[model samples]
Target: MIFPLTVDRVFADRTRAEIGRSVLTVPAPDGTHVVLGGHDSTGPEDGYPIGVYATPAGEGRAPGLADDLPAVGWLRTARPLRAAAFHPVLPLLVLGTGSYDGGYFFEGALVLLDLASGRRRDLFADDCLREVRSLQWLDAHTLRLLLAPHDDWEDRAARSEGHLVDLTRSDWRAVPARSLRPEDLCGPRVPALLPQPTPPFATPDPESPRPGHIRSLTELPDGDILLTADHALLERWSAAGDRRWSLPADPRLSGGPLAAVAADGASAWVEARGDWRRESGTFIRIALTDGTERERHTTPGPAGLLVSSGIPLLVPVPAGYGELSRSLFRHGRHAVFRDTPRAACTCDCPWDDDEECACACACPLCAGDSMDDEEVWLTVVEADPAADPTRLAFPGTERRRQICPWSWEPGETHYDGPGVWIGETDLVMATVRYDGAVRVPKQGFVTRRPIGEDPSGTPRWVFPVDRTATALDIDPSTDTVLVALSDGELIALDATTGTLRARGHVHVHGVPVIPTALTVTGPGRLLLGTSDGRVLTCRPGPG
Candidate 1:
């Protein structure tokens, strides 16, 4: 019933290279423009595929960039681009770059280029970041940024945090992040965009019931809320908003962030994380009544544990790697170069500026056998634990279906990795992978599928559009899907037929608002966490 897959990373890269996605062109205040280039798939021999090209603004539009600006500046990086833009009115340009630790998060740099002097400096040139995910020029004097977490070992990974830079201040200093409204994105004189945060949950509460590592939120038979917090902590809350009791989080047992938690007829099944730093982890059994450890075992985990039938099922994911970044069964090692010893080779990717060539190693263990060492694949194996841990396969072919089997199809795109379950049986997915002839992760699709017996299931309907979806949530009451796009657009779609229901560029206090966290509260009501780390609650009108 599981569809295990081994994505040919190298072959995938070569395919992307052949596609050669085009660059994005944004106009400056003047007639001149800024072109943010694409990433190169072949190798880092030339540099990271990202580049910044400026064209000379003559009396009119320059006919040809190649002839006019023969020498476009290249910003070859091993990391990827999170945000790139030109200063509102200055000759300086800025970009945010980072490597994806996993999923949509990245670790990287805030690079600034002085076009007049042709000198560049990385604003956040430190080694501590995943990447600069959001960047904006509030004005010529100020810039704002939202940095991705460098690691996902704790609660910080789920929250959006940002930094403010005042050109007025010479050196970098951390400042509290301020939410943006519509006027902020389009620049001065625009009307205030987003509404204020809804009452109650809008304000901050330092001492409030802040729960981390929310592995699962379940309701007991009597209407009580059973919430599993981070570090193996569990709490029972009354429907009246009272904290009934919290179980002890013993350090001796597994106390890291839990992956999943479930309650059966008697005991609760919890997947506890280990102190991956020590390369050690364990699964522990607890007695629901006394809150005492019944039994525990050491394993290659920081895994998700559950009880199926009578046997214990443990899902060991790629741990110690950034969230959503690791493989299901890597033997604590990545694919090494075929021609070199694990010692002779840095194992670092060339794009990251490694001085060696991989000739592309494709390790089934890590999918690096052919992909760049820096590339990480998204794979999951759902099955019973094997006596010999070496045997593992994700999305196994049996009972499996290739949702979007054909890459570069005429109208379809690739699966965007993660998706949400509609109600309990259906799924809603978004992607940016079609064969539109553009090299960019352009308008993809948000599709729905009715899963029954097959894993290679086809979508019931496909909603095609010009935006790359970043997140999605379904409103059961309204029968609509809320899609968060990378470009700061919040939209609603007809859930049943895959049609557009509503669309808008949400903004607060003149700054356009996008969402990093989306939760459908009830009916037409929803909560949105902005890229700037701010929050807003609203209901989109019907189409």
Candidate 2:
């Protein structure tokens, strides 16, 4: 379903605004309206009711406005809904909420509602259920819900849990097969800390809260669930609520709560939010494994990661906008393979003292940056098949460095855009320059070096695409590069010869489209995500 505006974008200005409290107006059949109440961040005394509002057609939109008329609709309360999940088969809306005391510490609930008639039924309202952060429909009647205990709860009580609720069950006892916890699922135990003493005979202070609840949950192809917690921890949970793997934060790597999680068959990708002043963040990847330990792969940002058709892509958010900016990274595989950094010399004067500069330092693989340049490097590590236990190895062979020659400026003058992989060998990237008032296209180039290469020398090829190519992807079988322009046109280019192969305009339902995300499903199938949150899948004919 597509909305006129995204939830994030609509409430962009309100950071403290409860994402769950934002009411979503979904149009009902027969041109009537139903108000899907969001989670209430305000205290329970505030009476943020979780219910469905049925309003007459002329009263307002299907997701009717709360301020319409007095007698326009009836309020049906389930539990102050924290999240709503639609059953894959039945026309039911699953509502989630947590317990809340006067000051936000509250256990949540999961309620099932018939969307058509507003008939509500409390599926589970136990005090044992914590905040229902996320819910996914596993099948027709089976639903997976991510739960975290109330805020004021002790660390020992704050275990992450997942419950499989069977909607078809008659008895509530039969609905929940078992409660799955992190410790029960994974082998290694996460470190637990006792509350530190405050001062000499000081009054007992309140407990520090855990990071925000799971920011998002995604299902992997292998049935492993990816849970991104409030504290920037990305844990892999089994369908049975066992923790399969978890990624620890590296000090050198900036971290934040995971904004989103996406996985292809091979690896899972996480988009981590960072400080706005930093102007960058980490896009981490971890292999799907059976242990609680995991490895990390770093990428450039301000960026986000998405997996489509088993290929991982990085979507870069332009500088200055922080989380609000949206731009698509096309040709991500090429960026990973081609623009990775190789060994370099980092002496103050490489030319002045050649012998002193002989020591290996950070240098650009495809393009060399001087010692003074603020550079970002991409390092790609591949699995070594010949190694014992099949461990990942940095071959030192496939590395490329890209030089953003303009990052040294005081204000926001550096150009940033998503990089794409074209064909098998080229890295395509688009960058924009803001000249005070107007933002103009700076340049888009394709890298020439292979995945593993030294970047201290000149690049092999640098072809520029005139218009800003926000999204790019190569076809599954062909060497054609699919480019999504800011103007809503999808163009296919021959990566080998830099020739245009095909072109098509994007449309959703019937409106012109601006794609926020693009993925090549197959040789000709393309999936496009728009700014309005509508996903369009289409097949483009060859030129």
Candidate 3:
């Protein structure tokens, strides 16, 4: 049975229709507010036409392009500006460019404009920084920059470096930085946000390596553990604690069977994800007898976030703007000529999401941008294993679907709710619980409810946990519910009563690991993957 969901409560923090845009604050040097309005559609292709203009602050005048608006000193560049600000004490302006148009994998650069003299200095130092994601003018002569690489590049590791630019000498130097695996230095989105923040103007050890921890783990009926690795590999461990089988070790993909797994008596359905270089992924029917691929089903590549339960494969459908942004990025990478809108939705809500962006203006720039013509909805996609996942659905509304609160909320430093999991006949949802503007810490809850004939009602029960659960499993034989928290803790609870049973930590290959995912793989076992690239198994106790 399919049950519908709704938003229990809503809180929004917004000023103007700001979504994919930034507000530039310039001193104006004369008390007037200097506004360099960002174009909702500007990027690498169309370029950024950043101009400085002074507007009296607190005026009711909405920000936009008007014929009467005066341009003081303007800087035109083919690169999109990620951040820009005028120097507080000097006649200089600083702009930062991110990895737009698939530029992150290679390098990112910075630009400095002498507003008074109109002299521009383009800087690309250290040969690193695929994108300068964040920038701030530390002083009249010092600029601080945060640098990062793309999400799925070279190794399983991610690096963050800080740069201090000397405006006086027109040079830059490295500063104290933190280099860790990409998983730990994550941003609000998948594949991690470029330019993870680091301490500015100071020196920290730059050597960092975020080891490939476990990605996904599930227990088999025979008490075996089936796990995936961040390096895109899969393995099976028998009940006797021996390596049963492993997939072809592809160093490039370093992927695991992350989407979902459906195990039958003698066979299993596994999501065989490939590298981003491909346009599709394959679903393999593996024989439990020897762990060989028996049957194969091919679906679109970048099926990066997949969740399945044998019958239907569920994918997290990016709301309209996200889809378009991703599409543009992909096209930009492939030189596909998106021919889409250059302006983006300034309101946090996508322009097409009328409910959220009721005040969104359908301006000429937006109209001319080809992508602005269509609407994208937030909904769960039901993909057929026999066909490509090209369809989406909404149970309650036409344009929007029920959303997980923690997923897209603005204040969320950590984003959860990536997929919809259907474990056996029970639906498991691990989400955060809030109290007003203050989020109740470690109060994340795991709500489970068996799919009943009624199709609509309250959950079976909701139990609180220490952090947002990364994985949930229901052990039918023992009637146990296993939840994995982000901090790598596993909590066992009674499925029927939702009472605390037992809690413990998981270790893989003798090292304590941060649990990435979990599943009840066998009769008396729970399987979990950690952040350090190991698949470990555990036996929980009854509390």
Candidate 4:
């Protein structure tokens, strides 16, 4: 059941150029070829056809970031990726993808990809069969497929399609349905998004403020909360649970969703994008007093809130290149051209002057890849938009490490999680560790580090949580670190000692929600954002 998949770097670049998205990867059973799944821009009327391709399964190579692999075979089928399985003994593959059509039928395709001949054929030409839920091989000559019903809206008896195909047959469409064996049906495989249940420490406030995906929130100097919603809506709420003023959604700012907001005096900076896929965005300056636009300017790339010395400035935000940016932050590597070798040098020394390193190894500083190679720096961004604005980068030591799937080399550690600013130059970050593709969060440790100087020295303190931290904030007055865990627990910790102080449950309307963002409005008072698009004002009573 385990078919390892290597990174297909060229597939995304190629798909993006064709105005499409590459979403799924299915490696062949024999491990010589792999199948790619996605949709292209030009498609038929039914829907976006799933573009399937078989490419060579390159093994042992370093998987160069720039090398492009040509497709050995191709199949364009309607619908997205569903279930796909390769024949146990032949050079044949079967896949199905589709959903309930708006009409009375569930229209989809059961496609077969022939690796030996580079040809594709659909088993069914009509819109009667539902999506193929699972594909399995009973033997070398027997292939089994389980499909959903064509229509299941009425009170009729539930029906499912199961077919045991004879590989010797020329046409699969004529194969009659038969009763499935226990081995032919697969159990629940795809996970559903369900809320994690937890005990409620605080009762739900019936009059909770309803906001649609609170993207960014900040407490103003006068206790007003300025926040942005899913689209371009900007709103201000008073301390006494009242909506002060809301700016209507503007079509001019419809580049993309509003990413973040940073308040400075009477003006607030609201970042709006045409879309996350675009390279440029706009930062609109709006008056906090009346929700009116003051001014705005176009930014070069995706910009986010970066706080330095209590001053919020717009800075470049890492898109999907978290591992690459982290390597630059820690190792000071700078060249990202496709031609540069990933293992150019094995020096364990930081760059001395950008021309060379202190180690005797011919350092590849010039040909290295980096975010900013000028000096050591500590850059921090909130796991969510509203946790805190803390970005720190200083000179750091180089450590040879294992690579996460996202990194280009085997030297970068992925700490791309929430961080809360605890001091002028110190913050606590949730570190992520990977064992190949499996995330090892239990072995992960939370470390507090100073960002104003060389970070090679021992950290101030280290602690382990054994769980993923969804959001992190700090009570500046008490130095108590606030952590919103992914499992619906709100934890408080001593910031200076890294010791657990207390823990409590968090719920929205008596239902547990995974906290996505948090902002401490005041001592014992806070605002919590949930994954289901809710903004709740919470006041923790005694215990």
Candidate 5:
């Protein structure tokens, strides 16, 4: 029986909005204040405008553009920040912004700002060069710069250029520094923000055939392990951790990059993802016996592979700026332009209905205009090799057929992560939280729902966890589902009741282990693929 309930019931716990990332920071020489930089939109396509704020050093708070920070200045660059520097012994600031133009050239400007008088000027005299990788004040009057390549032409020697400018000069023009090398300039590095697996306990010998970064892993029917690494290679490992075979996922032969892999009786199917700008992928079948190529078929966009009842199903993952984009736009934050609604309501209502209602029923400007613009309808692609892949709607949400209306608070963005089948009928899934500039799956929850076509079907229960689950597997003997967390936590939940049965941390030889993949090898025994390119087996007990 289906029971109608409040939208809040859809979530195990209330969701919260996440803060965006900071652009660049330039601190005062005395350290009394810090000039922070960031953008006001989702990306450069939407005329991205970056803002600069001077916050008190002791305040210890990084404020967003929407926050009530004292804005020292703002720039309408329509570009992302690349480098920034504060002038010494002078009331001035230099900010650089640019990025790859999605095509041939890297473009940006070097803006000189007069902090005392609010005056600004673009220092570049012509379009001969762009993109400041770093800046250093050579002295009180001269500034040093390292500009990225003008175009994607060739190697670093041909693309990188450097300049030196004396602000005291009448023109303040930049002159090419012939002796400057790319290594002479330095700035903050782009971090590996995504959660990563741990390295092996000890480094491999220099000559060992190293398995690159593991993306995903699964256990084969014959007790062997199969995994995709670096989006290029697929390798098989024996039950005892011996390398069986490795195959290259050449884009010409296997779509683009290896994404999802599934195994059948004697064959395995691999999905190679498409480029970010397109919505197509490739599905290739390989022989399990010797890792030989078999057949290939064009498939759907970057998706997950699910095999049930001897059938292969492709679940399409949403592209960029999905439902969360709408929420961000509604709350006065930067989001994609298409995601912004044509209209919205400001009144408080229990439900968004337009007819037979008492609240704003006749108002055309009410909030009842279907809040389902970009809702991702869960679907599956057929396994036809000679015909176009047909998309059939599965048991997920669609436009105006929401199973769980969003109940997240302002500033919080939510994302559904990977899932696993607990039994023949019930499906276990995880929802992650967006933090800073990336989605931090470590901060999410788990839920279990039965297989059905009802859009409003309620889940069996929702189990909120403090850490995000990186992988999941079932221990059929104990009727328990094991969740492997990115931070090395192993949680066992009752498959029938959704109750937490046990919690343990994964460690090896006193070294903390970060798990990237996991599976139940046997009764009470678990196998894990770590970020450090190593496989380990452990039995959770009182340790």
Candidate 6:
């Protein structure tokens, strides 16, 4: 008997309004109720407007305007609201607003709103209020807001500047002082920002671009902080606002905005995205010492690339390619195939002695006695440092040797994942089963043998558990294998004896998590990154 499974569809209706800006829900003073920011409708048209909304105690949804709620209050603003941000721990909201006519700015002001009393207090104001880019709460009383100079006439009369305001002392200060110019903050020369003509998703829309968009900023092990931009510019800054050093992007690869950044030690692993068709998308390894660079061309349409102990692994998503073509480079440079001979030779010809047959020999090992011409051409290329690189350049000349004999029929699905170098001679490959017609439980089969061996050798399969595996990482110290599954579970397999060593469920904040990226930090520490932007460090337990 066969069983079929189906998924459910659910949808919710959301009201559309032009008055309300993007508002974030926050906890109120009572701790049970929630306070919503007032809508900010400030722009070139009318002055910025502000309104507040609230939710009932213990309720999840926001209360309607007609509902009677004692915990809710609204405050009027003097000018149109430009931008607003909620405090991390306090019931305070910071708002910015201004007025402009024909690109000429008039009055610009920053206000602080107290949710408990519905009272509005002025924070700061200037003649050149352009717009607020971002607002973040640094501490209980300290707030960081990014302000752009107004692009209006009245504001043009005054000097344009970016200011940082301190709500605790009610004071404003210029950002980066007078040393750095605004043009320096602007983005470098970039390719045309035109969207793909037929993007895989929806049509692209032009949004106001932030010139100096900060990418990843993480606190180091020490008190210092590391910051990176979209253009692969890494900067280390001291806690006291001191610039240490700035590393430039690689000019050869035309390294554009970075896609991801991971740090192991003093070195940082940066994956920058470039135009592949234009010979731009290349992965580079940068040494923080003197900004030395090494680059490698990876698989096309690579989703991400990870480095484990200096070994780079390319993760490419299958897109628009057939099944056979999709498995081309899933594992690595070397791919194994199970081949069979077409017929047996009766006569002991001289050509068959050296494992080579003439063009008209018609032996199964030669060109003619095969069932299918396409299947007869299966050849595997093994990387040999000692082999002449020039001889290996020909399509099928130097590496036209077979390793395994074709005895049994090939499996419908191919196994492709991490390549494990078990010892100096043995190289084991992990394979998984994937079928589009029927749902089959995923399993791992190991193909192990000595390097540079003939195709006559057989490979053995090793199954750790019943779960479907997505990725495999081998521990060099213990020879234990870490397998990441589709169900968000990680299992450890002992490669030497083919036994299950350990298993554990990965979670973040008590909720089950699916790891989007996984890397072995050390022999025992495994770094897991989830789709929800959470990272967890897991160490192996005692046997």
* Candidate 1 TM-score over all chains jointly: 0.39
Per-residue alpha-carbon lDDT of candidate 6 for residues 1-543, written as tens digits (9 for 90 to 100)? 000101111000011111113243444344444433323432211222234455554665555433433334444444544456666665666665544444444345566676656566664433233344445676665666555543534543233344444333333222221232233233222221111112111111233111122333334556444444433345455544454664544443332222223333545545454433222124555554444444344434333343222233333322112111111212234533332223333334555334656656544444434354333222344434443321211123353345443221254444344445565445555555545533334554544545455453344445534444444556677777666654556666666665666666553222343443344545665555332223345565421
**Which of the predicted structures, 1 or 2, would earn the higher lDDT when compared with the native?**
1
Candidate 5 deviates by what RMSD? 18.8
**Candidate lDDT values, in order:** 0.43, 0.42, 0.44, 0.48, 0.49, 0.41
The root-mean-square deviation over C-alpha atoms between each candidate and the true structure, in angstroms, is: 19.2, 20.4, 21.5, 20.0, 18.8, 21.9
Tens-digit per-residue lDDT, 9-46, candidate 2: 11111111222234443334444434345334222112
Distance (Å) between predicted and true CA of 152, model 1? 31
Q: lDDT score, residue 401, model 3? A: 30
Model 2 segments more than 4 A misplaced: 1-269, 277-425, 428-438, 441-467, 476-478, 541-543
RMSD of 1: 19.2
What's the count of clashing pairs in each model shown?
43, 29, 32, 22, 11, 21
Error of 6 at 314 (Å): 12
What is the model-wide C-alpha lDDT for candidate 4?
0.48
Candidate 1 deviant stretches above 4 angstroms: 1-221, 226-236, 245-298, 301-313, 316-368, 371-426, 431-445, 450-460, 463-473, 483-490, 503-543
Instruction: Pick out the ten consecutive residues of candidate 4 with the lowest summed lDDT.
Output: 3-12
Candidate 5 segments whose C-alpha is farther than 4 A from its true place = 1-213, 249-264, 278-280, 300-304, 315-317, 321-374, 378-414, 422-425, 433-442, 453-455
Q: Which candidate should be chosen as best, given lDDT against the real structure?
A: 5
Better of 4 and 6 by lDDT: 4
Candidate 5 lDDT over 1-543, as tens digits, reads 011101111100001000122455556665544554432332222233334455545665544333434456644554566677777767777777667667777777777777767677766645333666666777677776656655666644424443333234322323232323334434333311111222222233454333323446666667777776433446677766677876764554322222233423666666554443222245667676787777766643333344433344444433333221211001111111111222333234444334543565543335344544433332222243332222222223221122332213234444555455653445566656656554233467777765444453356877887665667777778887777665556678887788988776554322334555665667776666654455665664443
Runs of candidate 6 with Cα error greater than 4 angstroms are 1-411, 438-457, 464-468, 516-523, 529-535
Clashes of 5: 11
TM-score ranking of the models: 4, 5, 3, 1, 6, 2
Q: After best superposition, candidate 3 residue 468: deviation in angstroms?
A: 2.8
Identify the candidate with maximal TM-score. 4
